[model samples]
Target chain A: MNTNTQTTRLYHSTLSPFCRKVRLVLAEKKIEVELVEEKYWENPPDLKRRNPAGKLPVLRHRGHMLAESQAIVEYLDEVVADPALMPRQPLDRHEVRRLCAWFDDKFNSEVTQPIMNERVWKKITRSGYPDSRAVKDGLRAIKEHIDYLTTLLEARRWLAGNAISLADFTAAAHFSCLDYISDVDWDRSEAVRDWYATIKSRPAFRSVLADQVPGIHPAPHYAELDFG
Target chain B: MNTNTQTTRLYHSTLSPFCRKVRLVLAEKKIEVELVEEKYWENPPDLKRRNPAGKLPVLRHRGHMLAESQAIVEYLDEVVADPALMPRQPLDRHEVRRLCAWFDDKFNSEVTQPIMNERVWKKITRSGYPDSRAVKDGLRAIKEHIDYLTTLLEARRWLAGNAISLADFTAAAHFSCLDYISDVDWDRSEAVRDWYATIKSRPAFRSVLADQVPGIHPAPHYAELDFG
Candidate 1:
């Protein structure tokens, strides 16, 4: 069994939205973590050892190995109660989780996964060249997603509700990854742009903003807090 | 706004593992619910109105709309705490969630989705014919998954631990769907077979046992309590 310690460490991939969500939550809760980037696609022996499921964003804290980005983020929020990432009411909490799934599951399949697979993973993993059709489809899908998010933001202060919750972090994580590759059209939705700018300027986003993926340059405004 | 009543209604599909999971949880909690079968692929007008994500397994309770199977199940466990689906300790709870994700995300992708897409959805949705390669791949993947689950059962009575938690229900949900199409080769792993038999015998599983998708038939042993 791994010994318990005050230290927290996360095994992650820099460009993964799932990993970024965990990082953002940890940062928001003021938890210090040592980030170790793992090349999970190569079937690293330690990766499966750390998480039996062999997934990224495996967090080792207080002698427990936590996997599943949503589960880990919720655990972090529970353990660190001062800045709660989930709302108090059950109905409101359901909304937070529902939206989290929207981004992690739906948005990812529709936009982030396909786009990254075509433009990013192909280059990083030495796979075939980008498929223009897949990229075009992802770009097209993202517009509808942005419009949906714009509608959500127009009513609520944050994605889930009035408070800044894990849903915002989850959505931002996916958006940031697409933004890194300059796939997002900032001119598309003013509401979404404003929401992004507000979240991007937070202290929790600093480390993510500083992410430097090898051989793939970030967009010029990727790290700029005042991009809006 | 929908009127609040004593009624708890679930909008779901027969073959969906996610819907099965919610059914199992609600039944375990002894919450009486009305199951409404929905053709989500057809994108019925009320589907999006009920839940903006337009996903199945949307539970309507006390006039609150709940989407995302995991979120709904968790909410049910929280609100109806008599037969708690989640463990008490954070570590144990994390393990439960991790295993839940294991079955829901990894196992679903590698086994259920591929197999179901080929065998079931194509027939129901009138899409292309089943790809033999995809079905073969899903069958091949389930072998390794069964082995893994067998190992976990060797160490612990249940998938997550000694107690039957949401992980067990989540896993059984997926397995039940595959079993419905007579896809599972239960003879491969005695341990997994025993686990399924144990979960399947529970009273909560009765409704799922009685499920009959149109034009598709359940295996002979699907509803048998003494299948083991």
Candidate 2:
């Protein structure tokens, strides 16, 4: 593997879906990097300087620094020469980005927000009681997003296209976190469920699945579900 | 140019920030296409078929289609080869995406929302009277966002790096809409004020800047402010 494996540092958290997406991309690209776990809540000045938006998953490559998941993925795709995670054509690539944005924006807001906020943020932010209404809303939204995913999976082998792209990694990253809280109904959408199983079983995703978020315990089915 | 040109169609509204971002990208890339102005408030089935999320600025590239401003801009960047709107480095690109997301998510929510809702949405959505409180809040937030951009512009020639990237376009797109309502204080931050002026002067931006939203009239300073 001639991929650039020099002192690339990924400042990420074990539980963040965005960080997990970058980690998955790095693994698939066959690049090795030092993963630095970030305490985003602590409001570290160095991390804040690295990302003014003060979000997780800031990547340091060579001397340049970057702060968004999609941008980081695109940069990785560009800097490395092999195993493309993005498509070559304009439209096909658009489809990949569209799905990636879908997961980042809508799915994160709808499905992941409720579950993560309830299960993780409650323990992390350490504020307010876990409202049942938000939890129910998130659960309901997750089901709908999964149905949409199922529709995509039925027509395409992968989430966005024939081969595994950044889109699949992004979706699985979000769902995996929700799965940690047991918010997702795995049986609800078989096609999407099956697609996720395959993505989870990938060698690239091993570290992400194995990541332990301190006080939280992943749902029991998290380890049992098989993609193969 | 060897880049492939498809039957590109943009489903957009002149007033939407997301749509304006796509329009700016098309201008930078110099891509020619049909612009289908969508009346999103009507909930047209055609628009829903293109984007189930019912969002603005859905780009149709030949057989493939994409929703979300970030995704559509990226596709246009790839398909049209001139004037690259994104940086080559992973980290720099991340900064661009992060800022773009900042504008789309934070600025829009914190600043654009209050202004649009109070100013245009009341009229467009036909809900009720625009809230003065929200309008006042939006005005306050816009100034802060401008200051943030001032810091970024102080260090670099463009928002993300030495050259103009999509980050500038995204910012300008938002401000242009705000400028439509005479909401932005152009003199507050000179650097940001100038940056927006640069984009507004572009031939691609002329059409968008010239757009009239029926009953609204822009301040004279909007078209006159200069960054240089």
Per-model TM values vs. the true structure: 0.96, 0.90
- lDDT for each residue of candidate 1 in B1-228, tens digit (9 for 90 to 100): 234455799999999999999999999999988888899999989998988778898898987889999999888887888987888887888888888889989999999999999999999999999999999999999999999999999999999999999999999999999999999999999999999999999999999999988899999999998886
What do the candidate models score in CA lDDT, each in turn? 0.92, 0.82
By DockQ thresholds, what CAPRI class is model 2?
Answer: medium
Which candidate number maximizes lDDT?
A: 1
> Fraction of true inter-chain Cα contacts (below 8 Å) kept per model?
0.63, 0.87
Off by over 4 Å in 2: A1-6, A225-228, B1-8, B30-33, B87-92, B224-228
Q: DockQ (C-alpha) of model 1? A: 0.74
The candidate 2 chain A region of ten consecutive residues with least summed lDDT is: A1-10
Index of the highest-DockQ prediction: 1
Candidate 1: deviation at residue A206, Å? 0.7
| Candidate 1 wrong stretches, greater than 4 Å | A1-6, B1-6
Residue A11 in candidate 2 has what lDDT?
90
When just chain B is superposed on the true chain B, each candidate scores a TM-score of 0.97, 0.92
- In candidate 2, what are the lDDT values of residues A68-101, reduced to their tens digit? 7887888888888588888887778888888898
